[model samples]
Target: MTETTDYFDALATALLKGGMAEPAVSATLADLRGYLTETGTAAHEEFGPAGEFAARLAGGAPAGEPVAEAETWKWTADIYVDRKHLNAYGDQGWEVERIDRLGRFVSRRDPEAAMCWEYRREVTGIKDRTAMTEALAPEGWEVCGQWLYFQYFKRPKAASAGPAAVIETPPEAPGRRLFLSGGYRKQLVATLVAVVLCAALTAYAVGRGANVTAILIGAAVAAPIGGLLGWYAVKRDVLTGAKES
Candidate 1:
């Protein structure tokens, strides 16, 4: 019963967050509550995941219309895969409202297929971040959000004078992905080095003429390096294939 109530409450919150009117959201929740009461069914059994359900509702509506302050809006749950991914959607006329540890939500009134957006991401401190933003301002990427160590920036599609030049992703996307994924590669190398060092130490220690001094020295160096790498890998959640950094 508690889980069911929590699920519906979360769904209601997401709908409201997506730009549905309070009365509309309230009415939807009320309808669900009544249905559940009459049928005695679990919320998940009926509605599925709240994020996906909200996405379906958001998608069903028309988009790409110019919005007024009081105009009804719609939002969908978005995956956070660095700023490049979000920029691709911006190219399609959507804009990110906010993104945090929980999830990302982007809003659009009337989405246009021909439009494009560009984005850039960086990891830096306040001083460097300010500098980076200032530099990017001329190119048109506006700072959007910062999640953990990463900062996101975006800009609307650039206008083209030539007969509607085809819009495409920025040429730097591949390079950026390689750069971001490089951290994990370094950790992987460190992990492998640790394993090989331990193996070599084990072999030397068990040899016919084992040297205690060599074994001790190897252990001292290997233990710290291996321990540090292991701890970092776990902290980065590399095993689960989460964000690389």
Candidate 2:
């Protein structure tokens, strides 16, 4: 048999021995075979030794009977602090399911069977998204969610640290949800001030019997302009912060 076949045989046998069901083992092999073909690299080169790779894969994916319910949590943080929180919660075995419409992270963990997870965020345009995913695929990162021009990827912590990735006991779920950074807080305050000022002006105009049509038209025009300015300001702040560090 060729080296590829030989490598897969060993991997499949290891996965089976590690308590992964047959169907899951087969799917994992198919995916890995496709990856090796696309990258034109040997399985051992791409994934290290077959035994170790199996340990990593099966460590995160231990098979067992389904539970009645799994613990769930949902929370969100600003771009500046999101990564920090993701890593922190992931260490405790929470797996993010998706980013909700409000950009909150919806996550869950099975008390019966749970493994440590890790996450990273990348910023890229739609055009570069394919390349970004392809580059990270070789390392076992899967796209978890995308929002606000940022892409989040996650992987089992076991993929890197082998058996060490096992979490014996997870901590209590965090209570506080919103984790806005100082920058976001400042922007919120500024936005509230602008809103108050606009409301005051509208009230004064109504008291003076100003044209309602004219006031409505003025607001319609200003809304987009204010939004554009806010977008520019946030981008500038991000860029400036990047350069400073």
TM-scores for all candidates? Answer: 0.38, 0.64
- List ranges where model 2 is wrong by over 4 Å: 1-64, 205-216, 236-245
Among the numbered candidates, top lDDT falls to: 2
Candidate 2 backbone collisions, by pair: none
Q: Which ten residues in a row are the worst by lDDT in model 1?
A: 170-179
lDDT of 2 by residue, 1-245 (tens): 39889999989988877776788778668756755655466888767888877765554444332222456777998767788889888988888866755677878776666678999888878778779999999999988776766889999999788887787776777888888888788878988888788888988998899998899899889878888898898777554443211
Question: Number of clashes in every candidate structure?
Answer: 9, 0
Candidate 1 C-alpha lDDT tens digits along 1-245: 88987887777766666666678678557755765665465878756887666544444332332222221222322122444455555654455533423333334323222235566666667558779888888877766655445567766555433324233332221112122345546666877887797878678677867887777787889689778867765545522435533
